[model samples]
Target: MIGLIKNEFMKLLLRKKVLISSIVLGVLCILLCLLISVAYKFTTKEAQIESQQYIIEVFEEQLEEAETEEEKNLAQANLDEAKASLEIIKNTPSEDDPNWRINVEETINILKEQLNGLPNDSGEKEEIRKNLLEYQELLNKDIRPMSEMSPKGINMLGYLIAFLGSLFTAIIVIIISSDTVSSECTPPTLKMLLTRPVKRGKVLASKFITAFATSCIVIIGIEIIASVIMGLIFGFGDPAYPMVAGTDYKITTVNAMIGKEAIAVFNSSYLSTIFSVLLKSLLLQVLYIMAATSFFLMISTLVKSSSASIAISIVLLVSINILKVIPYVKPVLPFLFMTYGNTTTVITGEIKISTLSSLPSPIFVVLIFLAWTIIPYIISHLNFTKKDILV
Candidate 1:
């Protein structure tokens, strides 16, 4: 088994497709770094204050146009929140400020005032409360809050891997897995291997293992290369920078002026360091890759034509994202293997308002991924073992 796996790995490494995929990933990493750098400049403290001023003006106009008492109250609430946030931004000290802790305390006080004015069960109130706690915690720890758009090396890496890396990795993995079996069927390679007294099951298992292992390597290699390049350009940032993870989405009824309304609230449950969050995201991504590879490999085995296999896999991948937006698909969305492809969102508990009710627990998602990996492999193994080879 080990020898067969080694041989498969050798064959994979010799393919030009693997080299092209690696180059594509490396180029994307560079492009993302440039994009983040530009974004950071546009999101400076001064820029934020200017933007907030414009927002305040917009809200003031809305308040003037309010025709009903409820409209007036809603506009007032929004205006107040926006004003308070502007105050917080203004009061925020520069990095070199010695009395930054005092500024944070003042920000916390402002958030508390905003919290008190909001309705007791309002979603905005809950969000304000969460910010209050985070601010208070920062004060207690004597740590300065990092800007969301900070382009520190480690920060960019985390952002890239969480948001962009997983999707691209999946694309490459799908391309590779879709061709794994069908590509060989067109040539005499598969036929020649079958005549070597090896069980068809062992041969299929070797292929699966090789494809999975290669995908894992690709993921880790891209990250490592990205980190090195980013670190050289931007300093390897603070690993101890605070991060929030393990968020949970819950639908709650909030007291509104006219009637009770339901809102989706995402609560942060776990707090850790940036490094820790990145590690957790990568681990989840590996599991996602396993499920993806197995599922696509099954398609490759089922279709004897490589083009057909790749085309079908690409369509299925695109359909998953499209189906997720259809309201009727919500009931089964959580169970679908592709729904959890964004490991960053899954780990951070960031769900769209439309799909809040469909949030699946981390354990449940793991189970679904496992089911995908095992079941698809089983079906593929059965077919590969029994089917006649035309090669």
Candidate 2:
């Protein structure tokens, strides 16, 4: 059994298609980095200038609406602070400006002072305090910021893996899984395997195990390469940077939520060790990808045509994802495999959840995933072992 599994793994590694897939994944990771850099270059400076101007306008309106002495005092103070921040934004000419760091530090200090003036017992006030303190730390340390307002290194890796990386892994799995049985059938390898003393069920199980192992390697390899390349360019950053996660379990960097940190403290640990946390958080997403892979493998085994299986898998996955957005259909489809595929969101306890009463527990999501994984493989096993192979 061990030798059979090893042979199956070797067959995958030796394939030119697998080599091509790896190259494609690498190139895509490089492109993700370039795209992020370009976006940062175009948006950050303009956003700073425009955002300060917007804040100034907003404070002026609030001052006009103030109806009491305390309200007026708070409004006037905020308005004065906004005007000062706008001046700072204008004085710092470029990202390279030495004054830029000084101006940001000063602005953060002002925010910290403002945080203390708020009602101490208010939940909203405490949220504001954390945001101020967080930005104060970021600016004082001169941490490189990205579009996600996270430290550049961790943000680049985490965002890439969470969004594009998940899709890329799914594509690779589909490619490999769709080819697993059909490729063998096309070349009469299935018949040769059947002639051996091994039962057909064992042969099928070997293929499934090999595909699962290959998928694990593909996911871990892509993330490692992306992390190393981006870290080299952007600097690995302080592992202790802070972040706030929303109710949906999605993360928001301290820099991103500069003025509003109402999120619970569950993300405090994640903030302190973002790089490691990101990798660990992504394991939930990886399991989601694996569930999809198992489905495709089952399709390939039962269908016996690589093209048909690949096409069906793509369409089904896409359709299910799109269906998740429909209010009417989404709630009714909890049992659907795709419903549990977003384990990241489920585990995060998002505000907008799939469950009717509230967000489903992570354990519940895991059980659904287990059902998805076990049922497909069982069906595939039964189908492959009983079906007559055409030579």
Question: Which model scores highest in lDDT?
Answer: 1
lDDT of 2 at 7: 92
**Candidate 2 TM-score versus the reference:** 0.69
Report every candidate's CA lDDT: 0.76, 0.64
Error of 2 at 243 (Å): 2.3
* Prediction 1 global C-alpha lDDT: 0.76
Candidate 1 residue spans exceeding 4 A from truth: 46-88, 93-99, 116-120, 252-268, 352-354, 388-391
Q: TM per model?
A: 0.82, 0.69
Query: After TM-score superposition, what is the CA distance of residue 164 in candidate 2 from its true location, in Å?
Result: 2.6
Task: Give the per-residue lDDT of model 2 (tens digit) for 1-391.
Answer: 7788999988998988788987887787777778877776645657777888888889889989999999999999998998898776665434434566665566566766776676644444545554555555567566533335332566666666655533566677787777788777766778788888897777877887788778767766676677777778876666665543333222223464452122333222122335444644577666666676678888888776667878888887678767766646745565665665434445334423344323345555566667777889888887787655544
Question: Residue 370: error of model 1 in Å?
Answer: 0.7
User: On a 0 to 100 scale, what is the lDDT of residue 340 in model 2?
Assistant: 50
